[model samples]
Target chain A: MVSIRDVAKAAGVSTATVARVLNGGTPVSPDRTERVLRAVQELDYVSNGVAASLSRGRTGLLGLLVSDIANPFTAQVARGLEDEAVRHGYQVLIASSDFDSEREAQVLASFARRTVDAVALLSSSGVGEGVARLIRNGIPTVFVDRRPPDLGEIPLVRTDSLSAAREAVRYLIDLGHTDLGMISGPAGMPTAAQRLAGFREACATAGLVVRPKCVREGFLGTQGGYTAMCEVLDLPVRPTAVFSFNNVLAIGALEAVRERDVRIPADLSLVTFDDTDLFPFVDPPITAIEQPAYDIGAEAGKLLFARIDGAETAGTDVVLPTRFHVRGSCDRPGR
Target chain B: MVSIRDVAKAAGVSTATVARVLNGGTPVSPDRTERVLRAVQELDYVSNGVAASLSRGRTGLLGLLVSDIANPFTAQVARGLEDEAVRHGYQVLIASSDFDSEREAQVLASFARRTVDAVALLSSSGVGEGVARLIRNGIPTVFVDRRPPDLGEIPLVRTDSLSAAREAVRYLIDLGHTDLGMISGPAGMPTAAQRLAGFREACATAGLVVRPKCVREGFLGTQGGYTAMCEVLDLPVRPTAVFSFNNVLAIGALEAVRERDVRIPADLSLVTFDDTDLFPFVDPPITAIEQPAYDIGAEAGKLLFARIDGAETAGTDVVLPTRFHVRGSCDRPGR
Candidate 1:
């Protein structure tokens, strides 16, 4: 309960001097700054961040809500966003929604309660009603990775998942994969729908009919991928090649392939999205479409700062490019 | 600029009703709550989180600072901690220090300025001076994974790295390997020091002369591990087996080994710490001492909440057990 007045009195300095020292940036004599710090420590004066931020009209804190922090793609995006946040002298508070819209709403509410200066929401799932609340509260928000239709005018920074998926599917088709299967993300996620659309588009362009049984939707996790792959393998007419929505799914599919003693590329071709470091080292070096995850995050941060700074970027959508790494995981269907 | 009074007036309700609707917990008539929310939206009444928190004397926020969020171990730990935080109606803010003590200090200072309810620091490097400032300001903190000597009387939740390292080395020795090289973490990290000590202790117990050239320090990253492994490989007499301090380093060392066309188990045996899911599927599946990363994080969260709730658990260290998974990575080395 020690106040700034006590510290100012003990330091023999004015309240302004203590505030200047604590908040930094202002020019203060080194001697006075040292004395103020010493007094703060000796008197155990804890500055009320709430009171200070209230008066200043800025908290210097950004709230980031990611779908899953454990996912490498999201994690890298977070790192990129944090790097930008730190560069701008802002502290970011991160919370994971775990792909649940309810949890996303709760997290947004919590962020609001904390009064973060602005928020960046990264979710493949649909944007929830909490977003409307945040917008109504006049908090600046930027969507990263996925921008649902409902979020009509919110600024977004993301890679073009549809085109990337089409490119990956085209690559598989070029490998003579007419009987191709796909493991997609959750049903409601925009990214999942876009990727699925791309897959069908590519198949149609090649004059090939994608069998209904060959397409499966999985949760955005390895376990989900595994179960989906198992279902595909259990089919009477197995696919000669598979394109997974993301790296985690690809890995789970790989596990199922390995478990069933199916040789990669030789028995079944494979391609996945979001290439990670492990892709290059895996037994048959996975063929992958690498999204500019870090760049997307950084751009999201940039757009968010612009919004917070009162820029007119409400409808801005900064789409970065994706790279396809042609490795040994893809080949002409041998079966 | 819209205030609670404006919202209440618009909704035909009291300011207390608006506050209750916004804050939750208090059961009010559904109609009244709906009206208040509509008025808030219509008026764009953003709640002053700082002012509310100052009056209530609690922010319901916990800050977590980890060495590296990109690392899978730390990422999982974060997920675990956040799970516990959400379960207890608290939100977590995460920051990565990137193993720099200076950055760690900056993060801590920023956390203090944000006035988080409590903090948990997970660093393998060293804790810096900002800790003292936080402690002086009456912020409760608990150390996770590594507790430096300077952090006396601070509670810790970590696995017994020394015993785990000793066990790993002994297991390698049991496979009849005499010359064992080690890739350790940073020079001054407590966990690094303990693991190195355990390596040396095991060698001493086996009556083997420890060669200085056989031990190398890595920066707790893949690139550092690669460089260190390359250096070890360039030695005049290569060891029969190698122990990497963590999975990241082991993967880096594996890359170096693969680049040189060195066969595993036949040419050299490998053991590592912190078993990740990738370890089981890698070629010649690695032998590893798996630290209970998630459990450690959960325990740390439990301890942090205990401190926040006014429990007397300071000076306590919660030591979790490490599981040894012996896979195909080790054997009688035929060098």
Candidate 2:
């Protein structure tokens, strides 16, 4: 509650002198500046952000929107974004839409109303049009983990989902598994579609047919994966190997197999996408496609800051690569 | 970019008419309100937050400070806070201090300067005085996860760490283990202290001696846990049972034990604090204390909003319970 007048009174100086010292206006005598600083600290004077922001026409706040905050993958990316944003002297305002397009739009509109300096969106459910409107209104936006089809000139950071899926499938294939099934995320998601495309491409290149009955699409949570795995297990010719599009799906599949008393590798080989630090501890350590989630988040943050700093050029897209980690889960089929 | 004037002109109404329609002040003719709404949609007009805030003397922005964001426990809590804040018509700005008191102070100052309506802090490093100052300045402040000493009448939401730790240790003792080791978090953290106290109490009640060499203190991360486990393994009388303060430590111990080729439960029973969804998938599913992190976050957020809504006697501490989940990691000795 210390005002400039209080600091001035404590420092034996005029209010104008204190203001000058604080704002660096017309270089004050060094001794006087020191006295004012001491008084300010002693009084615990805090600047009024409303007055400062009104004078400057901008606040040091950036908005971040994600599809779901509970997902480990999104949470990791958010951590990276927050770390980078803090380092750059910006604060992040976060909102989650639960993968609903209308909710995503509402969140974006809210951010726009707040007039955040920039926005970082992880819009897996395709709310590009809402983002386009923000860009048109001169709000800098950077998409993370999900890229829009027509966002050719907008800034985006995403993992190479197609390549990651291909590598994951290839790892299982290399382990001498022929009968393969896939548990994909919701069909409308770009990342899921890309992964499925990669899986089919890998199968075709290996002279194998991707059976229609071997794929199921649903939510990306553990239950979704569980239900998908159950469907796959019901097939007369159940696959000896399976590639799950995300970590939650892989976990669900693992649970299903364990409940059914199926021994890993001997009965089934599994590979998952989007590996995290926790995966190594799984029963039989899962072989997984590890994307650069942290890197993608950091890069997206950097890009958004650049745009906020008046980079007028159309933003570019960045696709980080994935690493295939081979572990206890993906062994030779029937080993 | 569209202003009220532009909307009024486009809608063929006076500016005051447009303003009335937007603010719902007075009964605007329904036809005129419709026209104004149509013009706003067509022009894609976004409200100017700066102008509105300046006029109202408040911004609908809340600040959230966390010691660490990458930790699954912290991340889940953050998700709950975000969900509740959004529902209550507030936006959350987040900062991570990595348990550094200085960094936390800086973030608090920054949030104060941004004129945030309130702040919710997950202060694991114990610096409540700074936040108390903000509250004195009329900024509503709420603490989560870690309670600071003498936060006289300030609000806080935390889990029952003492009881949780007691349950974990008692579970190990019931399995017929006497020689116990513990991996504690940094010395000053209240949660760590409470858990340690609970562990000692359990030992005393069970007539077991506490060995000084069996306790290690550091950040609750994988590396810290791994190094602590190494030290415990080197002890002349290695513990038959171990309790980790968090999941990161549990994971680190898992890797260390794997490297040492020591079998879990059979050689050393282990229980960790803060159960995560990932635990169930682990090779030997980790036994853990499940803190109600999401509830704590949601409650803190709700308390903050209640304070903001002019609650006369708002600052109250809320403590939730933790549940013990026994899994494969803790079993009868020599299983």
Which candidate leads in lDDT?
A: 1
**For candidate 2, lDDT tens digit of each residue in B1-335?**
67778998999999889878877758998899999999998998877777777677678777888866778788778878877887887767777787778888888877666468888888667676677667767888888887677675778788888888988899889989888999898898888899999899999999999899999885667888898898887787789999998888888878789888888878898999989887887878888889888888888888888888888535576989888888888777773
lDDT of 1 by residue, A1-335 (tens): 68889999999999999999987999999999999999987886767777777788877788998878888898889888888888898878888888777888888876665478889988655766778778767788888888778887988888888988998999889878899899988888788888999999999999999999899998878999999999998899899998899988887888898899888879888899888776776778888999888888888889888887788888898999999999888889886
Candidate 2, residues A171-233, lDDT tens digits: the string is 777777777899998987888999999998888778787788898885867888888988888
Candidate 1 local accuracy as lDDT?
0.85
Model 2 residue runs over 4 Å out of place are A1-20, A23-26, A30-43, A312-315, B5-17, B313-315
TM-score on 0 to 1 scale for chain A of candidate 1: 0.93
- Candidate 2 lDDT for residue A253: 79
Q: How does residue A258 of candidate 1 score in lDDT? A: 84
Scanning candidate 2 chain A in windows of ten residues, the lowest lDDT window is A308-317
lDDT of 1 by residue, B1-335 (tens): 67788999999999999999987999999999999989987876777777787788877788899878989889988988888998898888898887777788888886676468888888755666788777767788888888778877889998999989998898888888889999988888888889988988898899877778889998878999998899888898999889998988988898899898888889889999888766766777888999888888899889988888889887999999999999988999785
